[model samples]
Target: MSPRSGLQREVLSLYRRALRMVRTKPPSTRAKFLLFVRYSFHRNATTISPRQVSVIEHLMRQGRKQIEMYEDPSVKDCWVSKEMKEWNERT
Candidate 1:
């Protein structure tokens, strides 16, 4: 496979930053935050074609904004359900 493009690298960097940000949350709620990040990023990945550069860029901008919002200390816990947990594990 060819090397990843700049936009692909940026998307991956954003995802890595989000995963790293999960460590800042309280230990008790860390799992919830983790599941949230995983779900949010993976949700639309299959639906969005790689050729859709405009859509990908727009979604990346949105993802960056969301990561910034959740990176704040105020975001201690995220609401996650049993089904969501199951899905997270399955994926």
Candidate 2:
């Protein structure tokens, strides 16, 4: 594959940060956070075209804000829907 574009790299960096933050969550609730992260990333994976730089930029900004909110020590648990759980399990 070709080297990732600047926007792609930023998206990946944000995703890695999210996953790392997931590791810091409480063990009992860790799976929930993982599920939420995986589902969220995949849910949007195909929805946006690579040529949509403006849209991609908007989403990356939104993702960063979400990761910031969830990274807080006080945010112990993440809510995942049954559909999300099932989708994650299927893959």
Candidate 3:
């Protein structure tokens, strides 16, 4: 698919995720708001790859549940740094 179409799909998927949060029993309006803000902010940035998008989305979802999903040391290596490009190559 073209880059534009790919990006549109990502944005829509994020939107759906945000919408789904609204149906939670206790009603996490605040959490949904935060999710929407973070999702929109990340979606606007053009420098990140689709792989990075998946990683960030997972982090957001699980982190919202208070899960320590980033405990594995290797996850930090995926974050941007001087070595990030080389790190991506190694993976």
Candidate 4:
């Protein structure tokens, strides 16, 4: 197994973070959200060009923003999920 490149690490990190956030969503919607996240990543995996660094960076920024918004308590509900919010409050 070869060492992973920086870009590969970034993509994996984003995917993991997105999934973690998805866990905070209501149970009924979690599956749909997971499917959408997986589909979006797979759809772009083939078309991404190594030469286009700006495009990759832009997508990363967008993904980060989307995650931030999704995790924000004010955006989705009056409070973040109890389990996760308690974890956040501790650290």
For candidate 4, list the clashing residue pairs, or say none: none
Runs in model 4 with CA error above 4 Å?
74-91
lDDT score, candidate 1, position 30: 88
Better of 1 and 4 by lDDT: 1
Report the C-alpha lDDT of model 1 over 1-91, residue by residue, as the tens digit.
Answer: 9999999899899999998999999999988888988887777687899899999999998998888998999878888878778887797
**Local error of candidate 2 at 51, Å?**
1.3
Which model, 2 or 3, shows the larger lDDT? Answer: 2
Instruction: Give Cα-based local distance difference scores for all models.
Output: 0.88, 0.90, 0.45, 0.73
Tens digit of per-residue lDDT, candidate 2, span 1-91: 7988787888899999999999999999998998898888888887878888898888888988999999999998878888997898799
Task: Give the winner by TM-score: 3 or 4.
Answer: 4
Q: Pick the candidate with the highest lDDT.
A: 2
Q: Could you estimate the TM-score for every candidate? A: 0.88, 0.93, 0.29, 0.74
RMSD of each: 1.6, 1.0, 12.5, 10.7
User: Candidate 4 lDDT, tens digit per residue, 1-91?
Assistant: 9998898799899999988987888776675566656666765776898668889889999989988887875443323344444444564
Indicate the residue-level lDDT of 69 in model 2: 96
Candidate 3 residue lDDT tens string, 1-91: 5556664565566555544443332342344334433444454455556567676666456544432222232322212333433433554
Better of 2 and 3 by TM-score: 2
